[model samples]
Target: MQQTYQTLNALTNFYGAMTAAESARRGYIFLGSSQDLQRYYNAKADMRSQLQILQKQIHPDESQEKRLVSLNLLVNQRLSLLEQSIELYQKDKTALLIQNNITVSSVQIREKILKVIADIKAEEQTYLQDSLEQSKQSIYFRVFIEIFTTFLILIIILGLCMILENQWIKRERIRDLESSLAQEKKIGDLKIQLFSMISHEFRTPLSIILLSAQLLKESLENLVDRQQLKNIFRIQSSAKIMNHILTDILILTRAEAGQLDFKLQVINLENFCLNLVEDLQLFATTANMLRFQKIGSIFKANIDERLLYSILSNLLLNAIKYSNNETEIYLILKSEADMITFQVIDQGIGIPLAEQHKIYEPFYRCQNVENIAGTGLGLAVVKKCIELHQGEIIVESKVGTGTTFTIMIPQENT
Candidate 1:
């Protein structure tokens, strides 16, 4: 009973020390900013006036912050030292109680006190990490505000310049200014829409992957069955989907900004398409949904192998995703006079007439098919990739009929 009482007292002291340390650290952080320091002093004086009332519930020990002000140790060491001091104080208090015949000596009390100190350090480390994360969030918020403010300022300057020019010049300038502003607004809206779509689409699937992996890791004993392997395959499929979305965003941004770099080489188009089809077959829900409609003859193309692969892969993946569960997705390659045309035809819910024009706009989902899953940037990336290769994409679709995307690229130079 005596030993238990000592342990309780030690725990109480430890908590009190931690609370005091936290209060002091907050006080110091407050001092770092003039506005916060002013508030702190006002609050401190009010507390000082109510000390008698506060003392009823608070400890009489001096604040840990004040005691460690002169120490030169790192933050972790300071916290550990404070905990050690509290442990010593608890031991002395316990010893005094024993001397007065109020309690008895406890075995291994020192070891227990040290263990408590270690636990306190662990908790403090956790607190420190949380604080760092909060600081980072604050910094990011400030940067976003600053960037938006700069954009507004530029828009205002452009408006003023348009108002002050000569009559004829003013008309032309205003037209250009309005056009630029409209373009900027479109870009901003698309970015916001894209970010929102990405956040929602990626979070659920990524979380599933993580949760499934964690479960398998924790209990492999009874989970070594066909079901477990199927679960693992599910995670792999989700990861591939995420990778495709990320690749689309990257290639789209690079192409839009005219920064896309390519290494041209001769690649066997037939073998390339075959390999791609094989790799993507695993991602298909059924074998029939994914197929390669072979070209009339083996054809070769001189192009960036990586870019071409990404373009075809993105197109094929989207066909599989947007098509009906059992519908066929065809990958047809045909060589004409001086170009090769690749067609991805899907017999799924067709694009609406109203949204057909906006299909290639970044993050612009068709109104009729918003229920389907997509980042809405897939087709935009496909268009950019085709344009970069001096190619063109033609879309033919009818509502409730189906859609076919035809991409034509110039044949490789001999």
Candidate 2:
């Protein structure tokens, strides 16, 4: 009974210390005072020490062990929440210092930290109430055992032991579930890292192959027959296509890993779209059938050049690949006051309405276009790039008619 009382007191003290630390952190955020921030850190350290002591002293009998475990789990959860809150607060503070402004994102982070702290305080209060009730129950059980006959006491103790065992089993199952979730998250992170590494490694060799193909085409231009010239061009085109695919894979992997960097530059919309269309014509089966139209006045916009190129190139390649050889593929650029829109319209096999949503998923290929050779990553890359630019992509398609992908990106200023 004495040890149980001591354990409960330790838990209470720990909770109090944690609450103080949270208060200090909140003060630091609002007051922006170094003294308050230092006090917050010191209080957190003291809370950590108190937690360690509480964990060491929490030794309960078999009948009370399940309650102890539940208390410990709650305390650990509170500690975890505190740590997360601290990290987010630090990040928000650093952002404020660097930018010299309090952005909406920073304010949101502060609100999230406050919510986490509130949850911790609420859990602590609930645990304290439960502990008080358990203490009262223990007192009653002890008094009853003292007055009861030996046989009756034994039966009562056995019943209590069974109840504790069941509770322990339930707690173990909950712990196992938590462990499984953590392991799954770790596996997902590892998969993304592996993808990023492999995609990066492929770039060096792909670049070499593309360069070799280009050199071979140049070296054999004079000596090669018409058939040989065609083969050389094919080799170059294939290598270029392979390189582009690898680039898309790398970009997607980076984006997934949150490492994609965007460098914005001013570019003329009309010339940019026209040049990309003309350059892609070299790879088009019906080169003469490719067309470009300017639907609005030419204007300059700030955009990431490389990402924009990938978006346009991928869409154009899909337009050419899915359409008939003789059909026209159109690249239309339209600039408005507040937004710029690029439309890739192809007069070929259109996407099915049912599968349109899945088209942007990584490595997803349309069932009707399965016969066509493709990595099925083009549209996925296009969609990701558009999202990075804070843009929207609208698909208009009919099963037999054609598909039109319209991308509208908001300008920096209206």
Candidate 3:
């Protein structure tokens, strides 16, 4: 029994030490602070000491000891990569960080270490369970032999044993739930990291494409030919679309990871809505016009400007994309005493009645709109932003006529 507890304690401590080392390494890489580096070194030493204790505790189980050895090897490999990452960052070689294998290998090694640790813990749990069963059987058999005649006492002891068994089962269920939650958290972190890496990789090329397209547009302004200008515009538009998709994915991942933040401030909603419409009008055509309307005299409200911008901009852009160029779009801002409402009305190819509920799901597009070029992320992003603001949106639409989106958010965030 003592051995089982010692092994379980060692496994828990080893995992904690591994987490500390990882946190410290990433912290040092991000901040380049001496204190962070010192923490990493301290964690590294503690990890080694913990491993020694873990090896000693699990020595009776060959399988667990072997798992520990494998874990140690992976930890060492990750530690080396972590050190290399710090060295490269300090030398102004961050550009090489993505091209090299260090980042990928480090993540793989860490995951492998975690797997080994989980396996060891599982084995330890089994050992403890087996020990408990043996102890239970021995005590029960002896007690029953001594009190075989005392039927009431036997019945009472049996009831107590059943209660203890149920409690143990409940404890095991809780532990399993905790383990599942931990796995989910790990998956969420990986998603954020993977999306972040993808965004970083695409951002530079997209920026260059936009810049080049802009330069070409400017340099060809005097040319008689409109074909080259159109091509340049196409390039710019495509790059912008790609950038928006990347941004949406990053936002969704952050929101899923519970990292999205809301910052509320007092602002004039009327002015904000007007400015947003004006900015969006730059993308409008002579055939398409944007009209803005404001209701209520006092327009000041507390809200997160960025989240509101995302929600409104996404709706407006979606309106523009799905509508005829000659159609008019209306953006209405209605500020009340305790609530503010935004209505974006567009004469566009409206959403299907059957699939309207799925529009807010990530990567879900209406079957009718498959011909249209979209990643199907805009509405999802808008929905996420609205949810962050603790608001609600109503969509009123017809298949071929038009769509109206109304969003209402409380003036004071609760």
Candidate 4:
């Protein structure tokens, strides 16, 4: 009974702390007082304390333990959202804007938290009711029931034997399934490890080959034969394409393992876009086929250049690959106070409207692209990179017309 009381108290205290933190956050945002900031910090501490207490109190209840995992996540998200609101307000005096944006999210998270708490309380109450009812039963009544149950059990022995035999067969099948699943997991792990190793092994040589091809092409600058020069350039282009493939493979493997590395660097947006376009255009072996443009005031940004490069390069290469040699592909860049947007537009073989959803899937090609030479990993790689940036991608396309990919990623003002 005392433990039950403690568990309920902890649950209520956790809720109270969250509410206090939210109130303090709003108070600080509106009033900008140090006292409110201090209150917020205190409330944060109390919430953690309550969470720990609840963890201990409900440790024995398996169902409650699972509920606690979700509860923990909700509380963390709420706290982070509240804390971020305060931080953003401090940085930009964005009280009204931030509050308005988070109002719906805040309400939804709180409602979910309340629902989970009520469920936990209901479970505990039912359990307590059952305990109380059992306590009220007389000992003689229980003995009578037990003796009656034993007689019934004797009469149902043959039925029990049959049920046990069926249960044994089910257990055997379950064991086989478990074994098969274990084997599959082992094979999958090996495949990932082997792929990582092979990508690393081949990427190094492919990079060296590209470098050598570049150097060889330069060294043979004095050669008058156009055919040799063209062959050398082909070697360089093929090596570049191969290097890009291995890179995508490595990235996909790392992303699957949840270890994609992200590091931000200051980059000139205009120069980056221009350089990327120029490089990919050379690889496309086309004359002035790609167009680049920029919008908005900001030109410099702190961003993960590697991931950004992957996202843009894949989209650009795909644009070049899918579009006709005579058609123009556009790379549009826009920067704002709070976010950056990229638009990759291609006026070539457009994706079928019905097949757009499957494009982001790795190695998935459109039915119309059957005659095209591609591994279909480009858009999938782009999708992974966009996710790592915590961004969103939208696609608009029509069969036999064209396609446009718009990506928006959030970042603070430079």
Error of 4 at 74 (Å): 67
lDDT of 4 by residue, 304-343 (tens): 8989999999998888888877788999999887888999
Our model 1 lands, by Cα RMSD against the true structure, at: 23.2
**lDDT (Cα, tens digit) per residue for candidate 3, span 252-301:** 88887898878988876876887788767645654248888888876878
Query: Candidate 4: TM-score?
Result: 0.54
Candidate lDDT (C-alpha), each: 0.59, 0.69, 0.76, 0.78
Assess the local accuracy of residue 86 in candidate 1 as a C-alpha lDDT between 0 and 100: 36
Clashing pairs in 3: none
Candidate 4, run of 10 with poorest lDDT: 135-144
Off by over 4 Å in 2: 1-193
Per-candidate TM-scores read 0.48, 0.53, 0.54, 0.54
Pitting candidate 1 against candidate 3, the one with the higher lDDT is 3
TM-score of decoy 1: 0.48
Q: lDDT per residue, candidate 2, 1-414, as tens digits? A: 344445556656766676667666666766666776787778767766765665565553442344445544554555455455556666775544433222333344445434543444344444444554555455445433432433353366458657755765565566777786675455446546655554565555455555545444434444467667786577557757866876887788777656677988888777688779888987898658789988766477889989999999999899888888778888888888789998899988999999999999999998999688998899888888898989999999998799999999898672
lDDT of 1: 0.59
Cα lDDT, model 4, residue 257:
62
